[model samples]
Target: MRLALGVQYDGRPFRGWQSQREGGTVQDELERALSTFAQMPLKTVVAGRTDTGVHGLGQVVHLDTELERTEFSWVRGTNAFLPQAIAVQWARPMPEPFHARFSAFERTYFYVLHVSPVRSAMLAGQAGWVHTPLELDAMRQAAACLIGTHDFSAFRSSQCQAKTPLKHVHQIDIRQHGNFIHFRFRANAFLHHMVRNLMGCLIAVGRGRYPVEWLAEVLESRERRLAAPTFMPDGLYLAQVRYPEIFPVPAATLTSVPWSAVWSDPASSS
Candidate 1:
């Protein structure tokens, strides 16, 4: 049977999502626990490969196995062996043609920045930290240039293995609640470290280091050097993954981040 699982994790504890030979990744731990639960070897395919220290809120994974188990049993059994940092939120049997990564059409990511003179001890590794308050309007204006389809090489990491740099950025929403700023990015797909690169550039603009128009020039240049340095990975979260209507994946909740409830989805604007 083919099964799909909605997984969540605190990225601070593992070395990213992909399985490594040294076995310190979220995938390694998950597979080990899952294999134990199945009483046989099992492998999983994920919707995205997040870098180390990047959290996952609505991650999707698919695995094929011969053992028969209910969705509840899968969650309970697999989680029994898994560590506290990782969990299988929900599970369901899927058609053989369903693919976790390829079938996904859109992915939503959120980046949180804590602006305060005093660093947060509780949010140290969970959210990005900045000493200065970010100008939401300026950041939004700069982010406007990123929407729609474009060649995003300037925002892409050199190690990215994506077949092409062109991607459709459907929306970029920046909202501030108290001292915390949340950035929401929705796209058809993302290159390795693309969002972090964009965040670096946007934060630069927000901090008065550059003019808003400079972003357009950087985007047009398509040179990675022209963009701001890639931002920290702590604040980035894989918020959601959207697939076709044919596939019914559970709508995962963001319970860990309290500020997530207050951020509104603004209409697309420049």
Candidate 2:
């Protein structure tokens, strides 16, 4: 039988999601735990592979196993052997046709930034920091120019392996909460470092380093060199992945941070 598992992890300690021969990745740790629980080697395929320093709030994975275990057992047993920073939140028996990656119809991400002049040691690895005061309206204007299908070559990393730069961006929401700013992005797919790259440009516009119109110009140029440098990964989070209705997976829970309440209020500043 195939099993799908919801996973959450803090990526500060690992070398990204994919397993490496050196074995310090989130995938390696989870596989080790699953193998230990199953009493046999087990492998998993993930919905998305995050880069180093990027966090996962609701990562999904699928694994095929012959051993039969109750849903609760799968979660408890696997988590028992997993590290403190990595966990199997939930598990369900899935049909053979269900695939974590291919079945995903949309993905959402959040980038949280500390906009204060003084940085907080507590949020060092959890959020990005910018000492300059950002103009929220200007950032919103810049983000609006990117809300559609476009060849995003200027926003993707040179190492990106995607066959095409074209991608559909459903939304780009800019919200402010006191000293922090949140960037919410929803899309069909993302290229390597795409969000970080875009964030770099948005920050430039926010700081008045570039005019809002410069964003559309960069998009039309299709030249990576024309865009700002890729931003830090500490603020990036894979917040959710949406699949078809046929699969009855639970929706990802949002973080209970004080700023999260703003997400549900349509009247809140954006």
Identify the candidate with maximal lDDT: 1
**Candidate 2 positional error at 29, Å:** 0.5
35-152: candidate 2 lDDT, tens digit per residue: 9999999999988889999988889999999999999999999999988988788898988899999899888888999988789999988999999999999989988889889999
RMSD of each: 2.0, 1.9
Q: Model 2, 184: alpha-carbon shift in Å?
A: 0.2
Candidate 1 structure quality by residue, lDDT tens digits, 143-229: 899999999999999899999999999999887788889888999999999999999999999999999999999999999999999
Candidate lDDT scores, in order, read 0.92, 0.90
Extract clashing residue pairs from model 1: none
Candidate 2 segments exceeding 4 Å error:
256-259, 266-270
